[model samples]
Target: MRLSDGPVALRPLRMRDAQPWHDLRRENHTWLKPWEATRPVDETPEMSFANMVRRLRAEARAGRTMPFAITWSGTFIGQLTVSGITWGSLCGGHIGYWIDKGHAGRGVMPTAVALATDHALQTMGLHRVEICIRPENANSRRVVEKLGFREEGLRPAYLHIDGEWRDHLVYVITSEEIPGGLLNRWRATHGPLHA
Candidate 1:
């Protein structure tokens, strides 16, 4: 399911993506480390490509989770994942994503998110989606805000990262609020968002 706005496409994550994923992550380690889960030195060895492939494939085989590698033309740029999916009365999940430092501000995550959210709602019949971002991560908060997810409130000690508990701002969106969906709302409103 590629969502195109020119030439870029947000597609599914592939097993072979391990190499590019590793390369990009390693290159952005300094930029990504603060917000990402801190791993043991051994856990983040520069040569754990096999582990990435195996884990990603196994996770994809399970029905409740979906992850994608953001791409442009033919380059793997980053990752986006929607996990903890629930059914029945609560069709919801949590979203986590990161953009390659080179791709951070070029609409990659936003488009990836729009396409992924469509899958959550239309394909999986989900009702809502949530994202909790560190209070200091203004850029991440902007991404959720651009998608129109309301601020749900503060969650003190919400995420475990950098080997410590941290606070986060909860943001959420429901199917009904999207007006058929994000692309539709954008088409109706004309252009993307800011702030």
Candidate 2:
């Protein structure tokens, strides 16, 4: 919730978000289809919003994971979630997100990512965060590179994306990388922010 971007907030998904969520998801269908889990035949675009909210709430209440919807100016813009969490040895989860196509490149994801990452490290007590991206997705690569996530390696034929097996570039940023505070971390990774 404490992101640098004004009016951008993370809130639990709700049934009321159904319509806007459907519209946004349908808008980004082809764009996001490659990266997301396969869609089911029984579901229409309209039903997806309710499904998302239901799933997120169930997961949260079960202590399985945390899911957040990104909203700006009363519109459902996107979603970010931390999944596959492990309590011990790994203490990690994969970070996944997507923004409304119209709002891309607006500094939305970075602030949201930083805020989410801070919550993971400082609040959830997680150690490492992982991001797996298709090698060709330059925008996503920029996000990770800007955030100082080290490129671990490529896993060939790692994920089913866009109806085919695609290689994924694994990236990670540990809690130790943050050093002292958010500003320092941002400066260290992305250089000085211009006034």
Runs in model 2 lying further than 4 Å from the true structure: 1-5, 39-47, 181-184, 187-195
* Tens-digit per-residue lDDT, 19-133, candidate 2: 7777887899988876775433426563455676787778777756778888776567988888777777888878888989887776667666776777777788889888899
Best by TM-score: 1
Candidate 1 on 67-108: residue-level lDDT in tens? 677777668888788888888799898889888887787666
In model 1, the Cα lDDT at residue 107 comes to 64
RMSD of 2: 3.5
Error of 1 at 23 (Å): 1.4
TM-score against truth, every candidate: 0.85, 0.83
State in Å the error of residue 89, model 2: 1.6
Overall lDDT per candidate, in order of appearance: 0.76, 0.75
| Lowest lDDT block of 10, candidate 1 | 186-195
In each prediction, how many residue pairs overlap at the backbone (N, C-alpha, C within less than 3 A)? 0, 0
